[model samples]
Target: MEANSNIPSSHTLWSPHDTVKDAAESLGIALPDEAAKNLAMDVEYRIHEILETAVKFMRHSKRRLLMTSDINHALEMLNIEPLYGYDNTQQLNFKETLVGAGGQTLYYIDDKEMDLEKLINQPLPTVPRQTTFTAHWLAVEGVQPMIPQNPLPSEIKSIPPFARGATSSTLGNDITSSGLSSDVTMKDRDDQSRNKNTGLSQNASEVKPLVKHVLSKELKLYFDKVVEVLITTDPEKENLKYAALTSLKNDPGLHQLVPYFIQFVAEQITNQLRNIEILTTMLEVISALADNKTLFLDPYVHTLMPCILTLLLAKRIGPASKDNNSSEAEDSLKKQLAVREFAAILLDHIIKVYGSSYSTLKARVTRTLLRALLDYSKPVGTHYGTLLGLKNMGPEVIKLVVIGNLKIWYKQVIEDSNKTDYEINILLNTILDIFRHIKVEVDNAENTSDGAQSISEDVKLKLEERVGTKLAELILEQPDAIAIVRGIFFGEINI
Candidate 1:
């Protein structure tokens, strides 16, 4: 018998290449070529219609139980990305049908681990009875940039004054120094320009001319509702994290809500009573913010630095103390570890962009970041993503921190006999770097000085003893870093 072709090809997922011929062989439905083609098209159309409907439903669905598994799977199949509230517009993409929905319901889905069975078994009517075969067409999606050029939402017209002064030059310099591809360079430039404009409030609004703006009130209302759900007593409700992030996305001016968002993240990382999933989501939010420099200009940008630093430092300090009654005492060390590593990257950007404008912020940020890097020097606490950031900020910045921190460290550790050979070795390398940059800057400063008096013997001797000789040895050993050292020295002198 000729194969019937009403059924979809193969018993598994459908691919574009699957046709009536394969469908007929697999599902035993036979038909003429025209009929088979028409039927196949109909099936494909139906599948898409179902998916569109699913996506729409998931987008605004308030049913938490349904969202965790069934709705999530559907989203995965549909390839719909969840929109960050920071995104000005929400798009409901559909091919054929299922476009008509009752209302645009603001759905919240935390991209965290959850028990699919429990979610399904919940007593909510919206909860799935079984994995709805058709439900696989739905999803809440991930965040994407509204425009190809302006990857960040325009609402963040400028970074906070201090943050802009701190990160712009550093972020740009790092990108350029690292010899990154053109795309990365362009992005850094855009970010820097935006940040530079943002520093002066008068120009902030004009920075992002084509920024996408949505109805801010509607988004705020939805966010408020989501916050209500988050604080409620529902064990199955896990949508708050995404809701908070999305809320910030829609109305970045809702920067006031940043504290609430930070609190939520803190609860996840510190509160033993909270789910690990929440903590993981916090990390995701931070990574997202870091990846998009545009968002770094938001008013909440100031708060983020300390928050990130605390998280990194917490890791080094170890887990919460078992005996502590107050949760603060238990997690203090963890908080420190959390901040230490993360702040390094943020500061690196701050120093590179704002140049001398960020002197005050740079000093504080560098002090914290340098200390963390030195502390974690065995492998350095931060991974490659942020390491390249430190390198871009220049060896001088690193050296400055080293010279500053080394004294403090020596006072605390060496005098107290608290550190080991490993710690001392790390300090040595940092000091070596500092000296190299210092020598370069001094030479450049002297060369540019129009017949200035020669340096006093005493100052020269002090510098030579402190940094020059060691710098020479290290430079001779690794010539590649000499250029970087030279760049920092000359850059500072000229400025």
Candidate 2:
């Protein structure tokens, strides 16, 4: 019998007996025959357990092939220290050698040591570049875009068909079934046979429908023409301008053009700060778009709010014409005030219509207007715009923001020693208008009450002090100031 006849053929052929004998010889000790067999069996069982655990790591990493790191991780999980100096990226080469006169072959992996000096003297590798990312649409509206990132249609069609039916039919069969062509039936059958031979279905392969986005040429031309007429500087095109505005207001299929119009308006407002005509036209466009019941403006309210506020609070608008009389300047100021008032009305409409949808919309608008009002660097016109903007926000905002800040603002900014009496009176009258509105509400609240409208004298004195001496003096001058001030401070009446 052969020397290896005692070993079972079905069991693993690799034996750890040689490794155990070699280790004992290196230590100047002899491993007995029976002791070597028992140690070899123990080592084989431990290796088998490790390999089984390594397979689990392979599946967890979504890989079919086992790796050195997997074995190391398995060893760590089993509470055993893993072997070092094994590079997972390098392949291991095993050498077969004949041992002694018995002609038994031994397979051992070769692990050569590296020279420390040579390794340290080698040139360093170049540093790698930093990674970056970019974004593009892989699919749109349920169809994959034909970009480099997605596989081609031909590649997808190359996949072999199975027992399941195809998702769609071919063009030839579609034509033949529809009775559009009579002679193509034989050719279609021949193609079907060929497809079946190639493991494709006889039922035609499915092609995903391509959805194309297309804007009409006429609409594009109309959009361009309308914009041209609206922004024209020629005095003769005033009628054309009105026609353009009218078309925008009533046009049915202008949903796509709405963004373009908004962008155009924003650009024009920024570029044409000195052109009142352009500014006016932009405002009109906004109004017309807002009034169109068919168009949805909710998504764009934040974008539009800034432009409207700019019109209301800009320090100077329109060109200063040369050699202007006082009357001309006054008329020009009136025109600006009119624009601000119109913008304020539009803002009021925006808040009323869309405020409930956006939780912070009202607060954001109120803060912006208040900031503009408190900015002392701004001219009286800006201050007036801020005042009008606050008033249009309704009684609650006026009571919360405008009423509390009025006395300090009037004393510091409105009563500037350099300002003319006319300007000061204009500012004071605007302040007084707020008080007047509050007074009307107070009167109504008092008349509707079941009991007499009354406040303790001490509480009344404290409320007067909070109103500040300047505003208190102004309030006392009014006919029903006491009732109004009490109602306002106590929140019994809305402003």
Model 2 segments more than 4 A misplaced: 1-14, 17-46, 54-214, 321-325, 441-495
Q: Write the per-residue lDDT of candidate 1 for residues 232-348, one digit (tens) a residue.
A: 556665566565555455544443344455566555555532333334445555554444433434334444555444443333333435543365643542343344434444545
Error of 1 at 372 (Å): 8.9
Reference-based lDDT, each prediction: 0.46, 0.72
lDDT of 1 at 154: 45
Model 2 compared with the native: what TM-score? 0.58
What is the per-residue lDDT of model 2 for residues 204-320, given as tens digits with 9 covering 90 to 100? 565555645456998789989989999889999999998888888887878777778888887898788788778888999999998888787876775677678788888877766
TM-score of each: 0.31, 0.58
Runs in model 1 with CA error above 4 Å?
Answer: 1-259, 266-283, 290-297, 312-316, 320-340, 350-360, 363-401, 404-416, 420-464, 468-495
Residue pairs in collision within model 2: none
